[model samples]
Target: MNWTWFHKLGSPKWFFLWSKSYALPLFFLGSVALVVGLIWGLAFTPADYLQGNSFRIIYIHVPVAILAQSCYLGLGFSGLIFLIWQMKIAPIFIQSIAPIGAVMALIALVSGAVWGKPTWGTWWVWDARLTSVLVLFLLYMGIIGLKNALDDVALANKSVAVIGAVGLINLPIIKYSVIWWNTLHQGATFTLTEKPAMAAEMWIPLLISVIGMYCLVASLVLWRMQSIILEREHRSNWVKQEVMNNGF
Candidate 1:
């Protein structure tokens, strides 16, 4: 395969065209996966021995939490791509993904609080995992704010790229928070290095949920990136022609 094709991805017009060809199918598949996973996990999965049905919240909460953290790393990687290769699409991707990531982080925090209330007898705690998650949410807000504060797109992108790169220091803290401190939050339920503690009946649905959530996130990000491309390339002839031809 010619590596030169990779450089073509830098063009907004090229990405827009490519996304148009595949977005519909990807969206359909992602939506189906999410719906099936949610139903299976919430209804079909067996209740935990200790937490009972309340543990079902993990189907929603854990996936969003994992994606929230992973999205930040993705944003930082986009920033690195922008800074190193100067790809025009890189900043747009970061911009497009930020709001979705923020919403996911917020959802994770809210769901975690709700779940914590029943299990821990409190809606809020200063535990390491919880606090780090809150900080992650704040970081998302900061990046969004920084992006909007600047009038020039390039300048805004540069500023947020710096912020995204810097904020990555929190990722490890968030991951190890439970272990590093005596937090109420439990350690990881699944790990590559160790066997799963939960039975297959419980873990299978969780795994399905995780995979579904990733697909959902990918679909959303791709859709948003296409929108960003449209907005950024609005004045360009190719975009105008493409929009006119597609009736967009």
Candidate 2:
């Protein structure tokens, strides 16, 4: 089998050239999808019989919550690749993604709290799922703090990679917390094999929002990875020449 393409992913110059073309298009499509989804869900879709407008927060909350967990999964995978294969781009991927994931986790928690207020009668709860999500946010912050504390690039990369890899255990706990314990949080709204629990009017917009969020995250990650590559590879002639030509 051909492993050449996979190996080229390790080259900062190659990745930068490849990703530069994708960032803008992804951002554009993501913005359009997100806007369309939010408007359709908030204004057009009928409100829930029980939760009313408050339930609409699901459009934003579910997608970001999903992304929060997914980003960590990606982070852990990149960390493992870095540790095992010493891929140069893997650590950069981790560094670029950590803060974004942290923000997503924060948004999920806050949106969940806002949605909970009208439905659950409170802003916060010590439910298993909620607590586990909080832990996920803290894990992101910890990785960021750990990276910042170390001045040595190599040491910082190794330390954060180890932490990111070890943090994978939390992902399963977060996913199963609603089932493993009696939690106020509800079960999954949308599943792959089974139909969505909600009406098509509701779930369709949600599906759009999730796809938009994923695209936006991808665009942001690519843009960030490009910047980090420039920062790390600035001493190389390709980086210097590219920067000079592009004026970035």
Candidate 3:
């Protein structure tokens, strides 16, 4: 019924001011949650009957993997918004998120490989899921590379939006890889429709860790977005006034 707040987010001034309210709080909360969850998962939880202590890596691996996929989906959605609505904030979303998504993909890959070492007897593989994920990583890199390589900001944003939009195809492939084909990687850890196969002591910390990671990602994205907004809007009157009065 009310699209007022939605359009308000399109304003760099409003969004930047609004973000200041939550960004630091999220940073502190996310850091605390991540620390507590990692400590609990790594030290307190009992080892898996099958995988033993090695399963502890799951605490980090799964959350980053989830973030990797989820972030791209958000990127694609932002791309759509930019392309259709010509929303100014949309490109800022891509600029802010692309690097973070790439880092998350890298974390997922390295952690997955480490997890694979004991489970699959190798550090890497050409398996479908792994390859698809690598492609996702490249997609993020492509967005970053495309943006940086272009001389024109508008053109760069448009081109990267197309790439980000097209890359949405990989999300489903990465998601269903283990189910679609036989793979060394394990299946879903927890799903809403089905009870988790893990014990409370295990999945509870993992759930907390995932939330923490999301919070951290939000903090980073907002921070980056704020930086971009300031730089892009530096020539605007509000920014000039802010710098003159606030000493920023």
- For all candidates in order, the CA lDDT equals 0.82, 0.89, 0.86
lDDT of 1 by residue, 132-213 (tens): 7787888899999989889998899888877787667656765576447655557866787887988888787787778778
Report the error of model 1 at residue 201, Å.
1.5
User: Where does candidate 2 stray beyond 4 Å?
Assistant: 174-179
lDDT of 1 at 33: 72
Cα deviation at 202, candidate 3, in Å, is: 0.5
Collision pairs in model 2: none
- Tens-place lDDT per residue, model 2, 130-162, is 676788899999999999999999999998889
Q: How many residue pairs clash in each candidate?
A: 0, 0, 0
Question: Candidate 2, residue 102: CA error in Å?
Answer: 0.3
Candidate 1 vs candidate 3, lDDT winner: 3
Using TM-score as the measure, the top candidate is: 2
**Number of the top candidate by lDDT?**
2
- For model 3, give the 10-residue run with minimal summed lDDT: 177-186
Lowest lDDT 10-mer window, candidate 2? 177-186
Model 3, runs deviating above 4 Å? 173-184
Off by over 4 Å in 1: 173-179
